[model samples]
Target: MSIDTLARTSRAKRKISARRWLVPYVFLSPAGLLFVVFLAIPIIYAIYLSFRGMHVSGGGPFGVREETWVGFDNYIRTFTDAEFFAGFGRLAIYGVIAVPVTLGLALLFALLLDLPRVRAARFSRIAIFVPYAVPGVIASLLWGFLYLPSTSPLNWILNQLGFADLEVLTGGALFPAVANIAIWSGVGFNMIIIYTSLRGIPNELHEAARIDGASEWQIAWRIKIPLVAPALVLTGLFSLIGTLQLYGEPTTLRPMTNEISQTWVPLMKITRDAFARDDLSLAAASSVVLAIGTLVVSVVLLRMTQKKAFGDGS
Candidate 1:
């Protein structure tokens, strides 16, 4: 071939190679733009707001309030606030009730469904998961009516049977009442994840266990559970995050009961600070703290479970 022709061919090949590289990025551009606009920008704005506060210049009611750089003042205020910490305490109580019960029920349901000769598995799965399909606010409302003494069928049944009324939405019962909303909505989703993981597990292991004189229960407890540890870890982490971010259910149910205070959970407190109290800086700081705390917790959990669940050596 002529030298000019060879050069033209080489340039053509280079252009095609560049086009191939650009194709993936072109496809990814819309998603990347969305992430930047919806997620990254909002996070950056919140962090910026965290470091700023409204300063009152000159004094008294006549003084002008202006946005000013406040350094760590917001964070300091967030840390020192009794209500903020109290919200965490409430979250701890809620988590203690919700997380274990949700995960346990999910795992139990997944296991039962995985068992041989379990009739109506599809219908059962749909029934369990339907609650999760209900929006959190709607679920809270549905449960709220059932909790109210006047409207509750359970209370009516007790009255009919000559039993005392149960105060579910008050005092100590309030915690479980709120937690139950979470448990009901969460279990089906977690169960689906666990069941999917269980299905992925090879049947040969179960066969091998059976051949070695192991019962179905032993095979599940030994081989299946261990193999699906990673799924459990994933579901547990999700539950932990959901527990920390508990807001919708409690907030929805709050109007129905006085037991849930305005600052019932950290997120609710943040919302109040931002919107109700108009303390944007304080709310931003609280949000940043929560986001950091959640990140740290997720990291710690994954690190601790990596070896056992994921079989990671590092």
Candidate 2:
């Protein structure tokens, strides 16, 4: 080939290589910018703030508010806080109660919907998912009213039947009362997730099982449930996260009962420390602790369930 032609070909190849390298990043720029601006920056700032303690001047409105670097003191205080540990204890119990019940109901509903010739399957799916569309604050308010002994229709029915009023808002019942709202809102959504996964399973699998004289229960137990185990694990992880961060329902119901303290849950305590006490440093430390704890728990759980869900462990 001529030198001129060879040089032109080399230039064309370099241009193509340059475009190939540039195209993906050009397309990803907007999303990458948004992730940095929204998520990454905030998390980094929170971690920075967690190491600093706040100090305000006594000099009125124009007073100087200094943020002093305190190393790990904020973290130490957060770890030593009685209210913080108490909140976690309550959350652990809440997780125990909420996660199983929510996942169980979601799985049950998913299986029922997966059944052949199930009546109003579409309608049932929509109805179950309706509560998921409702806002958490609104759901808390609605269930809070239902839990009140005086305003509750359940209480009225019990009274008419010569049964005493059920105090659902206090003592041992309080955990499940709050959990019920979480379950009511979450179960349908998880069901939709599991149900969608179930629908994705091939019809040939079911047909083969049936031909082998497997009953409907056997098919679901041995075939359907096993295939849908990943969905169950995912939903369980979400439920665990939600239970640990339990705040809304208890805060909403606080006005009606004396049982709930200002530090009812870890998130609630963090919120109070940040806004009410104007201690952002303490709040930041608590938030970091909560985030780390959640990450550890979720990683442990995923590892535990990995073999069953994915058929291999990493």
Candidate 3:
């Protein structure tokens, strides 16, 4: 080719490449900038604050303000504090009860909705999902009232059945009560996600299985479940994270029940540190620890599930 023609072609190719790069950046800039500013910056700041502690002057009397950095002191305090550790233990228990029950119900509802003979699927889906539209605070409030002995429908039903002295929000019942709230608030959205994925499976696959003399149960167990593994993994991860950071339901229900404490969950403890006691450094440290814990748990669970779903050979 002629030099002039080659030069022109090279310049045109460069322009096209530039446009390709520019187009992606233009499309991505808003989300990228928001993530950096809001998510990345706060996470970095929290990590920085986690390693430091503050000081106060003038006997640290009311309204007196002073601050200094004490490296690793705040984290040490968090690790050594009995209340902090207890709160973490409580959250672990809450997660154990909440995550599996919620995800199991979600999966069941999703599968039921996918069934061909299921009636009122649209209404059932909307009814199931309507709870998700309610704010966590409001849902907790509603459930709190429902747990009250004086006004609760469950209490009324028990009374009608000639039973006395029922307390849903007390003792061992508190665990299931809290778990139920979490499940009620979470299941519908997860059900929708799973149902969407279930719907995506081509009907031809099911037909092929049937042609191979597979029963409906076999089709579901061997084909549908395997195909929908990704969606289940996603829902499970989200449920795990939510279980770890449980705050709103317990916090809202605290005023109504003596069973819940101010530091019932890790996030609640962090809030108490930051605002109630004005221990911002300790709060920041706790926040960082919780965030890191969440990341670690999520990574481990994802890896384990991925191996199970896809096989280690992959």
Candidate 4:
């Protein structure tokens, strides 16, 4: 080939390569920039704030809160606070009960709805999901009334049946009561996810199982469950994180009962520190710690489940 022709061909190839890479990047730049600005920047700022303290000198509305770096002072204070540790202990209990029960019920409902002969599937699905659509504050208020002795239908029913001293939001019962609310509000959404995953599964897999004389239970256990493992992981991860951040329902229900303290959950404690006490540094530290704990626990749970689901048993 002539030198001029070779040079022209190389330049054309380079131009095509540049455009090939450039188009996807051009398309991706908007989303990438949004994430960096909205998500990444805020997270970085929170971490920065966590390692610093604030000082305010001037009086009245003209006062200034000066942020001063203090290394791990805020984190040290957070770790030493008894109330802070107590929140985690409470959350651990809530998580243990809520995560399994919520996910199990979600899985069960999804399975039942997926069944061929289930009656009123549409109605049942909507009824279950309706609770999830209710605003969190409203759901808490409604459930709060039901938990109250004066307005409780269950209390009235139990009274008619000659029973007493059973309150849903008292002492040890409070944990489960809160868990029930969380479960009710979350189960429908999880069920929908699991159900969608179930529906996406090809029918051929089920037909092959039936030809091998597998019962519905066997098919669900051996085939459907493993195939939908990824969806389950995603649901479980969300549940785990949500359980850790248990705040809104408890906070809303707090006025209804004395059992729920202001710092009932980790998120609540952080909010209290940031707003109620005006300790933004401690709040930031608490937030960073909570973020770390959430990440570590979630990643660990997913890893263990993934290994069991797909790893070589040998």
Candidate 5:
């Protein structure tokens, strides 16, 4: 082609390439705007608030209160607060029970559903997942009724059977009671993830194992479990993060039982500080600490699992 013709063609190609690059950004603009407004701005504002404290400005101790920079004072208070550390201790206990049990049940259900001849698999899946569909507050209320001695049918049944009524919502039973709610709601979601991963595994692998005189259980133990390791890691990470941020269920159940204090968990404590106590600076500091702890835990967990799950040596 002549130089003039080639120059015209190059200009048209450049325009097409430019338009292609612009299209994705155009489509992404709404989400980008939302992230900045809802997440990024709020985070930046919280970090700023963390360093600010309210103090009396002028005349006396009861004088006008003003927001002032306090450096790491809020953080110091957060670290030193017994109640704050107590909340984490409670979380550790709760998580130890909830996380493993939830994931274990999920893995079990997923495996059962993945069997070659699972009867009513669709119905079973829905039955399991329906709890997760229920709102946390609503589910807490439903369980609260069952837990209350006055309203519990289990208590009525026990009375009929000459056994004492159980105190499900109090003392030692409280942790397991709270954990049951989490497990009931959480298992289905994690199950779905594992089931999806199981489905992605090639049928040829299972058939080949069977032909080699391997039992179904052996195939699952040796092949299926290894293949779905990534999904397990993902669900584990999500569960750990959720455990760290436990709030709604415990908060909702707090009114029903005195065992759950106002600052039952870390999130509840943060909420109380921010709203109930009118200590936004302390709340912000606590929130920043929790967020950082969550990030570090998540990164460490992912790093530890990646070599086994994703086969990433790096």
Candidate 6:
């Protein structure tokens, strides 16, 4: 080849190589930086803190404090503690009630919204999704007052029906009460996600099913539900994670009722350990356990669902 042609081809290859490397880095930089700063740094710090115990020598403000490495003592203590185990049990029960109910309702709503005969679908969809915009803390506070016997409309209705006292925030009712708030707040978002995925599905499939004499129910069950399984899995995972990390609703309702203890949930227990009791090592250990538990549950659920839905290991 001529020198001029060779030089031109060399320059072209250099430009292509530079673009190939630079484009991905440019696109990934924001997320990479965020993951490092927000997630990686805090997790590393917590892991470091979990391994060390604080020592306070002598008394008063002049006491010297030191962080001494204690190996797996914090983790051992956390696993042995009855309070931590009880908290995990409670959260598991809560998740059992909340995640399925929320995801089921979301799927139902999404399917209903996708139907052609549903009137005012636009308005209804927007109205249902409005709760997602409300902060969890604020939602809990509002529902907390509404759950009170003296202030709740349900209590008034019960009083008129010859029962003078009805408390939704009490024992037995407390689980459903907490689950209701989570469902109400989360259902809208999940519904929207499922509905968006449903909309992406081709109308031809439904039309062909209809032509084949399939009923709406059959088509929904056999076609739409199967098609949107991935979205359902996504929503279920999100709900499961949120349920495992539940804190706001129970914590907010604590002042109003005696039902919720200091360690009502795992996160609440961690907060109490870290701040209320000033046991940072225990708190860090509990936090690590919580993170690991969440990770395990998410992975297990995803794998199970993927196997069932796609019939292949994910």
- Global lDDT scores for all candidate models: 0.94, 0.93, 0.88, 0.89, 0.95, 0.92
Summarize candidate 2's per-residue lDDT along 142-258 as a digit string, tens digits: 998899999999999999999999999899999888889999999999999999999999999999999999998999999999999898889988988888888888899889888
Taking the tens digit of each residue's C-alpha lDDT, what string does model 4 give over 1-314?
99999999999999999999899999999999999999999899999988888877699988898877899999899889999989999999999999999999999999889886899999989988888999888889999999999899989999999999368888888989888898999999999999999999899998998999999999889888888888888999999999888898899889888998888888898999889999888998999899898999987887788776656443
Ranking 4 against 5 by TM-score, winner: 5
Question: Which ranking of candidates, highest TM-score first?
Answer: 5, 1, 6, 2, 3, 4
lDDT accuracy of residue 287 in candidate 6 = 94
Clashing pairs in 4: none
How many clashes show up per model? 0, 0, 0, 0, 0, 0
Give the lowest summed-lDDT range of ten residues in model 1.
201-210
Stretches of candidate 3 above 4 Å error? 1-13, 57-65, 311-314
Which one wins on lDDT?
5
After superposition on all CA atoms, what RMSD does each candidate show versus the true structure?
1.3, 2.5, 2.5, 3.6, 1.3, 2.0
- Per residue, candidate 1 scores C-alpha lDDT tens digits across 41-133 of 999999999999998998778999999999999999999999998999998999999999998999899999999899999999999999999
Off by over 4 Å in 1: none
Candidate 2's clash total is: 0
| Model 5 stretches astray by more than 4 angstroms | 1-6
Name the lDDT value of residue 186 in candidate 6: 98
RMSD of 5: 1.3
Q: Poorest 10 consecutive residues of model 4 by lDDT?
A: 305-314
- lDDT score, residue 68, model 1? 99
Instruction: Give the Å error, residue 299, model 5.
Output: 0.6
Candidate 5 lDDT over residue span 49-142, tens digit each: 9999999878965689999999999999999999999999999999999999999999999999999998999999999989999988898889
What lDDT does candidate 4 reach at residue 98?
94
